[model samples]
Target: MPSTHNPGSSSPLTSFGRSIWSRREPFHSIEADHESSEQELELQSFQKLVVDLFHDLSAVSADELLSIAWIRKLLDVFVSCLDEFRVLLLKNKAQVSKPPLDHWADEYLDRSLKALDICNATRDGIEKIRTWHKHLEIVMCALESRKRAFSEGQFRRARKALMDLTLEMLDERDSGSVFSHRNWSFGRNNPRKDARRRQHSSGNSSGHSRSHSWSISNSWSAAKQLQSIANNLIAPRGNEIVATNGLAGSVYTMSSVLTFVLSALVAAIPCQDRALSTHFSIPQQYSWEEQKVEVEQELQELASICENFKNGLDPLERQIRQVFRRIMNCRTEGLEILSRANNLE
Candidate 1:
């Protein structure tokens, strides 16, 4: 035996003895130890890679190749990584089914699933950032377009155009298209009949009639005064001045005309009743009652007309305010874009 092997020297039997001793440890424990070692190594590698990338990015000049295309390329890389992460998560999830009878196995499975969940959450966050970046680009483009279309001069021109159009519409309304309906002239004389009678009269008769017209001159004078007031109230105000002052001037003119017309109507109501009473020989009490009814009806109709005008004006005002608000919002957004661009620069 002494000749075959020395006690100080190693032999194949010693290596076999070491192998047998290593097998004394649990197979599962050894596998877990190996897995943990691999995971630690991977984690360290990832950390080092991230640190190196950060240092490299920080060293790069800001003006160098940092375009939208670069961002898109980075996003493409993120997407690929996200897809790979998803596959890993799916595999981990499949492995998590059916709780293991062993408590350690169950805990390991739970930990694996938790890690997968964290990875999934990270992927979702990256996706959101990408989406937000895309949306930001769209908003920037829209702001640029709006800034081009709604410059200060263009806004001023648009406002002037709106004022001109409004004035034109008001002129058409005052020209008898809106307020000079047949119903508005219900008690006025027939122009055709008056003309025919005047034509039939001789020249000498016309002169004599004018001399004797003093008897009914007061009535004619009152009628003429009322007609003149109506014409003045309905006539358009200074177009040149209104064009410079915009909607405020137009509104002021309309309000002033409405006030004058209301005052004139109030004064004319009693005179109109008196004229009708003299023409028709009804009992004095009945005449007064009928006149009151007619006056009330006329006032009600006038009130309705004012209400309609006000209703229409309210919508126009709302539309104008809305347009102004939109312009202001665009301006604010434009300013924001400019600030962001300056910062980028």
Candidate 2:
């Protein structure tokens, strides 16, 4: 029978623990035993980190699941996992550079590129929400007058704002990407520095110029990008597991987390060609799979929230403010991560 406890919650000695144990030659000496024990502890720490992240996410109440606060928490989880994964990769660089693990790393990096596009699209979606918030502000101003009585002209103005908001949001659904034309991005805010960096990177053998690479074309589709990330994301077989020295599970876990988080964002936020019909086949043996039901419910709730964005001005206005603040916070975190990456290089 499958284990009842959350994958890593019950024991520090998980798959990685067993992998280390079996791989170690007989430790006849006390020093060897101490070293082997240390290895198990390190592996256990990583497993505990993963378990806590999923537990926190699954414990949220329904009302808070898809809200801006929850989204912020989700981003935090991704960043934390990413940092830990990076450390694990570095510590096991020799194994990572080998055949099967190398292939998995390449795929993970490719998925990360796709994630960058999603990040750009999400930023644009935040701007779109800001635009909608402007209309909400107009509606509030038009209706919340301190004058003796509401005038016909005030009602007319309110109606016009509401109509514009509804029509614009509707047009967004038809157009796929409403902010594709805008050249906004998270970093490279300085035009001169950005231009020079693009010029420097243009000569590299990567074949693609940085200037053209960062912008999402009009034809870019979030739904398609998500589908691409989900392609071939399956659990490793027993032989493959042995080849990677049990690191296959870690790679698969990180990839699944990436796909799930990005899919949830696309479902909740306005994106070009947004769709939530993507399917995942998470391995049942993994403890994290237990959280899958909660995740699906949250996505369903988010889809409903997206459809009802225009139903109530007062509530939406509040939501927009919260979203705007959270987006700004997330952007700050992104910049910090970039800075850390640069420093690491």
Clashes of each: 0, 1
Candidate 2: tens digits of C-alpha lDDT, residues 1-345: 011234333332244234333322222122344554543445555655766676666554445555565666667776777777776666776666567876776677667656766765665565576577677667766755455445667667767886787777767776765455654343324355345435423233231111122566677788888999899987666666657666666677677777877776776666777722233332323232455456446546544544444443223323333333333343344334444554655
Could you tell me the lDDT of residue 37 within candidate 2?
Answer: 53
Residue by residue across 158-186, what tens digits does model 1's lDDT show?
34443443453344323422212222111
- The C-alpha TM-scores of every prediction are 0.17, 0.62
Candidate 2 TM-score to native: 0.62
lDDT of each: 0.29, 0.57
**Per-candidate alpha-carbon RMSD to the true structure:** 43.9, 14.4
